[model samples]
Target chain A: MRDPVTTVRPAAWPKTPALKVGPADDACNVLIVGVGGQGVIMVSKVLALLAQSQGFEVKQSEVHGMAKRGGSVFSHVRFGKRVWSPTIPKGDVDILVALEWAEGLRWLPFLKAGSGIFICDTKRIVPPFACLNRKPGAPMRYSKETPAEVVAHVGEAYAIDATDMAEQLGNERAANVVLLGALSTALDFSSTDWERTVAEFVPKKTIPVNLEAFRRGRGWIEDARTSTPAVDVPAPTPATAAPYRIRLDINPAWCKSCDICVKMCPERCLILNAERIAELAAPDKCTGCRLCEWLCPDFAIRVNLDAPEALAR
Target chain B: MYIETAADFDVTDYLRKEMMPHFLCPGCGHGIALRALLWAIHDLGLDRDKLAVVSGIGCAGRLSAYIDANTFHVTHGRPLAYATGLALARPDLHVVVITGDGDCLAIGGNHLIHACRRNLKLTCLMLNNEVYGMTGGQVSPTTSETRLTTTTPLGNQEPHFDACALATAAGAGFVGREVTHHVPKLKELIKAGLEHPGFAFVEVLSDCTEIFGRKNDMGSSSDMMMRQKSEIRPSAYLDTVDTPFRSNALPTGVLTRNDRPEYGAAYRQAASARAGTSS
Candidate 1:
């Protein structure tokens, strides 16, 4: 386990960036991102409603068709005195709130060059598209950039574990609301207004928990803003020094010529010989996961991870 | 508290040495299921003498003969009936009845229901292979619809029985189902079933590779195992509705569980109370 990156944000706010956008007539582009069913739209809806309550024209556009089955669902909420487009232009988002860690990286280019504040949950939701490498111990194609690296790239980044915090609060579904609370600190919205707006969107019974979640999320950012530093380089991951030497002791006496280990071997390392007995056709490819040893009905395959003859196949 | 790892579990240690290379067809999933059962027994640290493996006549029944424990290979469809009596007489022994689809559901249907109702402290593992393998691959009650067996030349028209559901409906204290593809998980489920206080019915969806696979064109044993793994992703222990594997497939895992009183102790308590009144 690596040490957490200490967050050392500036003590003073930079004139409240969204409030410096000239007037309420200028649209404040807010993009909320997460997987389907993570309440991405709900966060955007709460924001849109809050802006609309303040008498601003809000055009909230989202694609939630993939939400039912858990795809990358995003909502673009641009509100101003006279909002024209429902979507925000590329690289013009004032604030980007990501409920999932990987998704935050996916939409990093859309953030404003220097002043954009990124409030993101550090919970990694690796999409199914990234799960292409099924080989044992294969490094997954996820974002390798650490929180500190991402924080360095943006003007302000808060990598909070909102989902974990909400889970501890007995309602994991309130994670979006927690992120919204964090986002509230970025915008010039009242805590009471954020709570009331989030309360209106969630169920009547879950108001108290969601409100508490919002408070916790808001307090976390506040604590980070004053207390600590966040530029700690993440400790390097320990590389696999030496793979376990795998050896297959195929007891030919018990092998039933079933071809189970031959077919089911993910590495295709095992093959049926001319005698119809399973043999290690490719020793280099074996990872010693023991799929063959467990699936062998005849008790013919015995995988010795640390074989007696360590070097010999 | 006794933690046992799979590396320490030697299947040969629990098997009768004389019964080496047992008489099951090649690529049969029963052998995998047998390994899981033995592994579970090993994990529980149960004494060989204290364990009773009773089985009805079928390929699964033949499994009891290979076990290096107190085994009873009873007549077809009577293993549950016999196990119910043995468990009541000797409550100290851990009784595990291994029955197949035809042996348990079609012929011994009443026995299974009554056994569940009795809630005896027994672990009944029904290895549903969808066909009677020993008797020339005949159609069984748990056979999937349109699966080709020797008896179902045109295809099986009858709806299959979800054994776990049936046991749960009959009020068995613990009901679960798992496939042979996930051997370790199957062992864990069996271990849980064994540890349950009251009656536990675990349905192991096995593959009769030689018979079922060839006839149904279900590919090799490896393909069959993959199909078992993919065709039915085991649903959550309690969340049976969020099924994503197949639209119409029955959910697996510990489908239902309750804290019902065990029959053996409950019966003895009631009998002693009545005897006290009579005296």
Candidate 2:
């Protein structure tokens, strides 16, 4: 709800931060990782604005061109006395905020080893690419690490159900704002300043809901900092798909020797017999996509993808 | 639009069952195109009695007789002319005109343009076989340049007419082009045209395997169909998605669509405003 035009932050920036930049380092690098449309860039904008207002030069760079279609989206916000490179070096990210669970695992190597603060949402967004396996019982290609394991690996980590909390607040889209609220705790910014900046970024009507979401997220993180983070129930095992058989009925009496079924078949398993009638020569090669039946001008071809288990008498 | 599972759509349900082994030649793409039109009608859940399919004289014209619903087999190149009057008279009827390339673009060229100009609520499906198959294989307006028809023995020298482009230029509200090889895609295109409120002109690239293919040594019915499919590109994937279309590929799908005022609705509004009496 910022500018609704600029890909980067269009909201008013906060005034100051706690000045937590290490003496050995020149800037504080916070990496916000999430799938596109999760408001990763928006969170980075808030951070950049707060740092800039604190008299520290802020350099924010992001990659979100493919974010609109559920693609990987990440933004780097570095603020200090004078920032140079817009990108954070690998293993140098002071804090890593992940809007999605799998993406947090994917970008784990970038977090500063043994010291980086890891705040991740327990929301699982199985991408379209993960469902490519067509086998009956094949498992999806996704991260297998659980919250317990991920928390144990990182020096300090908090896996919160920010999405569910936002949904309970009556806006699933505010999930990103919730993640932002959790991120605000990792920085030195004041609570009131963070809330005011979030209010500016979000729509006027949803200000009340987002403010409550921010408080809930801030509370969840604070509780987890003192105790163990709660683990979510693992993803349900993929169900075995129905086993279907491709059955083709080609009526020779009606076939006009058009050779359409034989030639247009995607598998090229169809052939003309001695009488030049269409026949399923290699039945095993047919996938039952029904290209033969649909293209047959003579209406001599009929295909059925029947459940093999149901057909057993 | 949602794609219906093929299991739900049966071509025989909409067809006069006895008409099986239709007179169309082996591998004639018209049958496939006909199946798409019927599938669209079936998917739309249109009432059989409320549908009026009108056709002109050609291979495409014979399609009207096979439909189980009401149909009109009119004279050559006059299906659109007849459809305009029929649509105005009975706005409730889903008037669809089925005509071949020769029947639509050549003989009934004037009617085609005027139909576009009027922007009536009609779905005019022009099946472009590129030849007059029913008339013993002659050159048609959509016939590609340097193609062999009985009339063009030495490969046609005239450039083929882009039917969808013509309809678009003539001010048709909705215009689309699709191939018969992809039956489901063709059905989806036809369905979109049917759903349009104003004049919808769909040019289906069909094959006359027996006549056009044999005369041009175009291998077999499947070969001709595949060739046409390979040469033309689906309109939906021209941008963003990777496409098989090369430089010479003819784009398909709904090419032109606009919010032109439909003749029937405007006519009714005017008549009611003036007559001020119930019909």
Candidate 3:
């Protein structure tokens, strides 16, 4: 590890990495870096939302930098004990995912020591000015560039032309999903179940092509591992590992006669009385997702995850 | 086969199936304006199938696709005209017109005034992003005098039109102006507009990230959103301000609300008279 004083310490850590079967911890940080409108943020959100669905404390930040002009964009995502910041600072990122090769170097500063596993695309986006300068302003310019030579100084790297695979899948938009697949192969996360997360992020219509891209991406990581050393990052820690109960509480003063809560409850657990006051019909059906709390206009309803039965009464 | 989870609300679904002529520049205020309108629909528990969203040809007009209800992407500056026909034809449907500054006050200005004058039972959301963003930042009727657009290199020589004041004067039953960034308040105003029985006009102050966003050095779409929170005063106090027509004056709410005779009621009366004469 680097000097503790220099390193940006995480706000909190789980007691253990629950996903790992051995002495290794089940935790790793993955940074999704790419140009805007290329689906960098979408990839990160899909992963974070998937992790969240699996009961993992996933913290994904909002998209940063100029996303409109295909400029650089990144989403720092870490899942463990309630992630706050999206950035990993410098030399702390476990996986450096570059949708484009130039972006790989731009974000290489965040790679961890002896642990910088670069899962990057060999594609290159030569911007408008580069074309004027007579530079090789072309897409997929790194299709032949030696991935090993590029990252020889930093650490180990795995480069894949995920764009070609995505194109073969029929749509170029699947390029990011392919990268996610490669990531799942390198990490201990279930690549098989990754589709569930991908589906959650994209609209239902775009799921099939995205699934194919994800499969291709995962296959690239698995195939590349035969020629390279496997990444030794820890497995993910699930958020629901610890047993916790939930209960519902309502503040009568903030209640509006809108009946939003009664309509919002999926289980028909809430009922509006003759006077329009909402009361519990079947409080036991509450899953405590806090969707009701977030949806309530008056902010009258709350979910007590800590004191479940106490608040329910 | 079955995908089960929460954290719903996807924008692409709106983009793919619904939103056509998708030219509402990325991060534009039109998206927020549309979102507020949809939130109003959701909050009011309005029947999705019974709702009809009509729009004119501008950034705001693209909203017909974003809403998951019956939508009509009418010709430029003709949303109110189409909406009037639709509302009168299908009185059970909740018709909403999403128009822009240029679409409403310039090309469709006559339609808007007449719609309010006739007290048509419709909710009109005129998004005032100041300039005509789709047509390469041209000067619009709602454009501030000193603002620089593509056509107005130095400054606009033409005066701006106060939409809320004009609608209130035109005998609209309900008229309100809200900045797009004030999402909660905007949602409430739109919900109230839908609930009203007659012509309800809501002027939403929005931003054009592509044209007006850069010319005025308004920063990126995200930075321009800060003005909504900073500049707009609380509705409770601002609505009480007299001389609401002054420039830079905070937007007011419910400018005019008088129970007037509706156009549909008059039409029905005329139809009954004609039926009796024929008999």
Candidate 4:
């Protein structure tokens, strides 16, 4: 197995085609669309954070359907000079980053002419209704109108089966990261920015595959840039602020290394010490989502938000 | 020796301290229930400083925002849990919970039943309007069977919950019912509920003129109130008895009033016993 975090090319940001519009022009609006449980909201949040780090005003709103079961989900992410509404009007979206190919078509109405980019994975998830009604499953039919095909037919498109790529990389859910890898080229963001975003958004247990998927996407973008002049976008400056500040801490004395804390750490920051106590592997990577503290069986690993001195020292 | 009438009772004074302006519709049952409770508090002469009101979300949940006393407006259906926590933490305060039927039985029904079973020292008033008035006329758990609502246009199929019966069965020390129009009876029930030593449940059948009236043709407030008095007669057998009965009949007076150690006091006793053993 790959050494999860170490093998990830954190610094491997190969130069791609740069698109620099003057600062006065508004930053383009990108919509990330997917079904519930497919991590569209996480991608939107990371995109929002990424945009903010690049000194752009960002506003985002998520429309979650009946999320417990397989349901249609989408997020409106508007980031530019002055974003008023969190919604992207029809036919105005610049980049549509879809985790699934069918989800890309689900949001096809918002694609603009000439500049619109549809970055998608060829994976298919048949919604429940299509299965129960004996109707032709939306998935089999949807693959034909792939994001790449749609974008190419309308303006520009990049289509890859990110799911197969991530599965080959040994993680299936990292499909979104693989698509994100494809998206980094269109947006002209750095690899460090992608890694930082992944470290913050994707929990620790799945980080390895997610990082690999991102690398795969970034590589695809680099290779594609050689063939076609990449979309005109300026390089995003690295966030100067100590960006990956972690808030959760583990108490070495109390933790029995029960693996519950490690399993529950959404950011995958906690590791086992010699004495079987859960310890922080990447203290800076903790986003303080606090899923670990809520699910801890032993109450060992604490979200040390209450004591500033203990955490700061 | 002097006898004074209720005319001297400043009902608004019993408002659980610094009350806030709220979103209750004019002449809403919740407003009447609040007035009756205040009158009861004044009649019982309870200390204002020792009062704690816990409410859940709904139109009634707005009670927390208004009261001057320590008030907790917890999540819908979770006020009892928060109230349980508060009652345990501060046993000295008179913990009173004001909740709507939908807020209590439908969402918070589990907590309400458990609180009664545990016999915690708290007074719970369930304001039943037969529909979820705040969120539109949705059919609520306490909504009467065959009643029309926004969600149940053809009429509600689900049988309404008898809060008093549920509480009595759950071992609450006191359980009673009264309509909002019967302010005197409502005040009496509220007083008894508050004075009870353990968990007390009082159901106040109220009017939802905007929803129930609009749908069921219950008529104007006065006509509806008059109907409430005429239609709702206290169970005859209960009128004669001084003590409460265990049967789940619709009686006017106190249904069940029995002495039982509250959950918090029992928990503290157990904790102290362990401490004593260790020492």
Go through the candidates in order and give each one's DockQ: 0.63, 0.59, 0.01, 0.01
User: lDDT by residue for model 2 over A1-313, one digit each (tens)?
Assistant: 1111121110112224344444425677889999988889888887787667657888899998866599999999987765778898998887889999999988889988866778899888999789665444457888877787788788777788889999999999888888888887767678988888888888899999999999988887776656655555575467565467778888887899988888777678999999999999987667677788899887888887778787885
RMSD of each: 5.3, 7.3, 25.3, 25.6
- Identify the candidate with maximal TM-score: 1
Residues B111-204 of candidate 1: C-alpha lDDT, one tens digit per residue: 9999999999999999988999999999999999999899999999989888888899999999998999888889999999999999999999
Off by over 4 Å in 1: A1-25, A65-70, A127-138, A161-175, A216-228, A231-239, A242-247, A282-288, A304-313, B1-4, B105-117, B139-173, B225-248, B255-261, B266-279
C-alpha displacement of B161 in model 2, angstroms?
Answer: 3.9
Residue A301 lDDT in candidate 3: 59
- Per-residue CA lDDT of candidate 4, range B1-279, in tens? 011324455433444333333356533566667767776777778787898888998877776666656777889888889989989988999999989888999899899889988998999988888788888888898887788898988988887787888888888888888877566667778988998889999888777776787799876554555566565647655556576464543456577788887787889999999999999
Q: Give the C-alpha miss distance for residue B249 in model 3, angstroms.
A: 2.3
What order do candidates take by DockQ, descending? 1, 2, 3, 4
Model 3 spans > 4 angstroms off = A1-313, B1-23, B238-248
What are the candidates' interface root-mean-square deviations?
Answer: 1.0, 1.0, 15.1, 23.8
How many pairs in model 3 have backbone atoms within 3 A of each other, for residues 3 or more apart or on separate chains, i.e. clashes? 4
Q: Write the residue-wise lDDT of candidate 1 on A1-313 in tens digits.
A: 1213222222222334344434433677889999988999899999999989977678999988777577888999987666778898888888899998888888989887766778888877776666564434555677878887788667777888898889999999999988998888777667888888888999999999999999998888887777664433442333343345666789898899999898888788998899998999998788777889889988888776663456655
Q: 2 or 3, which is superior by lDDT?
A: 2
> In model 4 chain B, which range of ten residues has the least summed lDDT?
B1-10
Query: Which 10-residue window in model 1 chain B sums to the lowest lDDT?
Result: B237-246
Q: Give the per-residue lDDT digits (tens) of candidate 4, residues A42-151.
A: 88888888878876688988887645676778887776666667787788787888876677787877877555766766666766554332211112223344333354
Encode model 3's per-residue lDDT on A187-290: one tens digit a residue. 54576568887877877898999988888787766566555533222222224322346556776654554454665565667877776766777766665555
